[model samples]
Target: MGAGIVGLATAWQLQRDGFDVTVIDAHRPGQGASFGNGAQLSYAYVQPLADPSIWAQLPKLLLSRESPFSLRLRLDPAQWAWGLRFLAACRAEVSARSTGTLLALAEESREVLQQLLADTQAHCDFTTSGKLVMYGSEASFAAARHQLDLQRALGGAEQHALSLADCLRVEPALAGSAARYVGGIHTPGECAADCARLCDALHGALQARGVRFVLGAPLGALRREGDRLVAVQAGNDWIEADGFVAALGTGVTAFARRLGVSLPVYPLKGYSLTLDAPVGSGLAPNVSVTDAQRKLVFARLGQRLRVAGLAELAGHDTRIETRRVEQLRRAAREVFPLACAGTETRPWAGLRPATPTGVPIVGRVGGAPANVLFNAGHGALGFTLAAGSARRLSRQLQGVAERPRTAAALIRSAARPAENSA
Candidate 1:
């Protein structure tokens, strides 16, 4: 019913699995939440934000507007309900389980993304440049080690904790702020690309494969007969599909409510800024870098640097607050200094559809239409997990059964500038 990355990727996977596909969206492809996302394809680091450590930062999260994370209490019941469930998921055990699940999905995604790129040959300024996550404080660095320990135990995650010297050795571009960082986690396999460009490439690729697209109209009412869904109204057109997947991002919550399904999806609004950063210039980072404390991520795609971070739970509002944008500017300038130009900045804000547990809901809904499946609530990882999650949903449409708890089980078994030709 939606056509964000999840929808487009789902169509791509389904067509590969020997099924006809149709993608419908109210906006142009990649113009939704997929647009302006942190460009890094961070497959190794899929940790959820709902950690046991959040308890220690609750005061800052709730009370300090200047903090990177902020939550506004609302009159909406959904917000209250989602908040309570999030609190329950803040325990140590739940966080670990979710991490295992996400890591497994990330591995599956890594494999599938390689295959997708190899087959479709889509180009989005892809780069194989590795990712470095730097921590400023001792406590933050220590807390990251716990996640590395979890990944080490689960397997397949080739991440190593690094001292400041080692971090600089791996990503010498950070020499500008050598004294600012205490430690880091280096994953050389992590990559980045222009996500919006990927969507455009996928949209064109799918169209060439005979897939139909109904764009520029909102999905209207769903026609249900008994326990099955037959068709849906998009503008004035009546489109019927044998099966339906709701990849609506934040729009799924309202869409699901019409069908008596209560999806635990809420919007976590985030901000991003893009600036001029040419490669080979000593000013910009050659690899992806994430500031653990400020929650900012910097990814250089072609000649542009994508700086994205900050979490504001203020419903579906997409307004770009000048203060928040300035904060991002300050952070980027402080970290990269000369890399990000003060002017020529492109500011963007999108609502990241998220569940309390950080695990995406990717299967059929109980008691709802038998053919209606969900692929929403991915939060910050919609980019990282889109390919694999869509693949799982495709398997369901093909009657291929996946192993239960595959994240935990899979562990036991286990781009450069030239990428433009992709």
Candidate 2:
């Protein structure tokens, strides 16, 4: 049970099917990854992060203390197991399959999100401002071009390769920093929206539509009745439903463990900073900008700019490091300097549950409970893929067969909940 974008999306879809829906969460809506995310609904740029090129970057990743991507080898067996699987997924073929799977899901998500927006008059600063990803090195640019080709082959959106000058022309805010990049890729139909706002809007809509919420109560346990989850223990209440979904994000791993099951999911911690990006100010970018080298993404949300990056794998820690925040601020400031005046900085860190292949698990694992499903392991693309996954899971619960068997194979695992003990 969760109240983030994914959980809320699932609840909304289930409510549409006439199930009495209830969202369970430890806190209020949008306080998790749904809050202060990169804010880019990357519809077309669905390339899997477990790429082959990461092999070459492993040296810098392992040795450099100042590196943005940090890896701390913990004593936990799950970390090592997940790490090895992640390495195995770094092959070209695996990446291709995953790209296909993600693109299909992303396309569906785009449609679902559009339909959701149309149905509700909720304002979350959603914009089709497009996305521009800048690559500084020729190698990186070539990789980006290859990724663009892959997406095109999978019938993705119309994306254009832009030279440095073209990048500056398209978004003049990058003019000051365009000297470093060789070229970039601009994907049309891409979007940027406040994820926290969407979560809030969904919460309000669900309430108005008669959905229930059990907030401020941390999930305590799952009381299963042999091959079926009859109820969930939240604080002092045991709420039962016809079916249950584990969409707890990072907490899904722990909750799954309580069910005597192990998930390949691990938390990849990422940070963000929100800045004052006033309208008509040339200092901020209206279109979403992704620095391929730094891994930081800048998206303009209303009058604020969301700057987010870094993937730190170090257990379940959610502490915001002042130095790391300073480092991110320094890098972002260097690229987009505003003389450090009249700008506010709001820092945030979140634990995004990610699988090895950067692919999410939508359906259930075989031998789990018959009525239990999983909608977690979305990693960083949680916002981008929430609606699609929710819709897919909804179809599964209703016994509606899914088409395009290939993509569905990757999105949904073979089983449901397993060994429903305790």
Candidate 3:
């Protein structure tokens, strides 16, 4: 059980669809990955990391402890099995299909997020400033250009390559290091939000809507009858629901197995750091930025800067490795040196529930306890796609025919030119 963004969003959507919803979590709402992410509501990103070229580079990444990607070899045998499946999905064709699926979900997610904010009259430092991805090397930039073409072919939104000067003009904070980047792509329609604050507001709204939140309660086990879920046991008490949603991130696998359901979800650990910006720093980045080489991402929330990266397969160990933190700081300094000065830094680690094909298992878990639905395995795109996936889940549970534009279809559409823009 989790009270993270996806969980809360799922509860909210269910309530809207006339369901009596109760949410339970092992921690306070939004205290997990949703609280400490880069806070990028990125709709432009549709590509999954299991690209075709990754198989060749896995050994190098695994051997280098300080590399952006890591795998804790001793954790869980299931993690290794998941990693192998992830590698299998790295074929070019597979990656394309996965990208298409995610893009569809992400696009719908953006719309759902906007509607939720508007309906609740909630604000969480939200902005439409969009996202910018810069390339440091010419080769990398060239590759990005090629990928953008594929993105366009896959129904991606309107995007333009920016020259060094234009990129600096769009984001004055990057002027000093303009030379380091050969070029950049700007998704002017994408948006960003203070993820922690958004979750807080959503939790409040859900409470007002009569949704119950059981916090800091660990799930003991599931009480099941023949082909049906009776209730969930937590500690000494049992809580029953008319329906159950498994949005428990990495915790889904074991729970699913107990219920005789097959879930391909596994944990992909990622690290992040938040730094307080100096007064009058003039170093604000309105748009979120992702660096390909270092796998680093930068997003601004008022005066605080969030820098997150490094996907380590460390098997549920939420320990913060100093080396990884240092790498994140180094990347931030390289890109925005002035922003890191005189700032107190806090490091964080979150397990992204990732699936091999990158698409979340959103449909009902057939042959399981009745009314059990899954909305997990989102990986890094949880924040980016939570609202949309929640909306999709709600429609499905209500037996309402989803609009023709489903999440999977939208991703394919977004990869193409027509639906690419916000």
Q: Every model's Cα RMSD, please?
A: 5.7, 4.1, 4.2
Candidate 3 weakest ten by summed lDDT: 413-422
- What's the true lDDT of residue 168 in model 1? 82
Give the C-alpha miss distance for residue 245 in model 2, angstroms: 0.9
Q: Residues 1-422, candidate 2, lDDT per residue (tens digit)?
A: 99999999899888887788989999998899889789999989988779899999899977776677988789989888878888888889888877877888888899988888887677999999899999989999998999999889879999999989888888888877777789999986799999999899999999999998999999886788888889998889999988899899999878777776677789999999888785565678888999988888999888888889899889899999987798778877777776234476768999989988887878676546767788888889999999888888888788763322222243333222111100
- The local lDDT score (0 to 100) that residue 199 gets in candidate 1 is 92
Q: What does candidate 2 score in Cα RMSD to the true structure?
A: 4.1
TM-score of 2: 0.94
lDDT at residue 405 of model 1 (Cα atoms) = 24
Which pairs clash in the backbone of model 1?
Answer: 127-415, 128-415, 128-416
Give the TM-scores of the predictions, in the order they appear.
0.93, 0.94, 0.91
| Ranking of predictions according to lDDT | 2, 1, 3
Candidate 1 wrong stretches, greater than 4 Å: 278-281, 401-422
Candidate with best lDDT? 2
User: How do the residues 1-422 of candidate 1 rate in per-residue lDDT, one tens digit apiece?
Assistant: 67788888888999999998888899999898899899888889977888888899898867876699887788999888878777877888777777777777878888888888888898888898899999998999998998898878977468899999998888777888888999999999998988889899999999999999999989888899988899999889988989998899999889888888777789999999999884464678888999987889999888888999899888888999999999998888888887865355669999899888788877676646878888888899998888988888888788764322222221121100110100
Q: lDDT for every model?
A: 0.82, 0.83, 0.77
Lowest summed lDDT across 10 adjacent residues in model 1 is found at: 413-422
Please identify model 2 stretches exceeding 4 Å from their true place. Answer: 279-281, 401-422
